[model samples]
Target: MSNSKLYKGSLTTIILKLLNEHDKMYGYEITQKVKELTKGELKITEGALYPALHKLEAEGLLDVEVAKVDNRLRKYYKLTETGTKETVNKLEELAEYIKTMQALVNPKLA
Candidate 1:
């Protein structure tokens, strides 16, 4: 599958799940983690990633902290209590989506 298409639907869940796993992470760290975990199958673009992060923050699904790291200020994101609940919902929804797709693609086996 094309990189864009593969990552299109899963970006938010990936981000949420990563935060769930790590407690907090910055933008670059999130991107790098996704790349490493996926073995380069996914490449997140700044244009796509930052906007989503901002949106989630606005929606109160994320809490952001700005701190000085070395020579620059970095923003780290963590799931709020609401965000943790939402992450569970999102993951369940994603799991259902995958199962549905699998059933469609392999009806006989299913």
Candidate 2:
């Protein structure tokens, strides 16, 4: 969902999952990639994105690399060893959560 509140809890998991798939990415790139994948249905705003990145970095699940691109510094993030492990755990948790939601949302099929 593009609505930030709806996806707030899972932002870290989404970020980690993306990093797991793509090696490394900067903030804007992550937002763009998410939007592209979701076909513009989901947009990660600056206000929501930076704090989450900082939090993940604080948690030791992410590593940051800064590079000078043109005249600006672009910071890229990748999963740490624990982060890689965490990606698998978080993904499993997310999958289970989605399954539960699906079942709840469609009890007849469940």
Cα lDDT of all candidates, in order? 0.91, 0.92
Q: What is the lDDT of candidate 2?
A: 0.92
Give lDDT tens digits, candidate 2, residues 1-110: 63668788889998999999999999999999999999988888889899999998999999999999999999999999999999999999999998899899998876
> Residue-wise lDDT of candidate 1 within 34-91, one digit each (tens)?
8898898788887889999998999999999999989999999999999999999999
Model 1: number of backbone collisions: 0
Model 2 scores a TM of 0.93
What C-alpha lDDT does candidate 1 achieve relative to the native structure?
Answer: 0.91
Q: In candidate 2, which residue pairs get closer than 3 Å at backbone N, Cα or C atoms, i.e. clash?
A: none
Say what the RMSD of model 1 is. 1.3
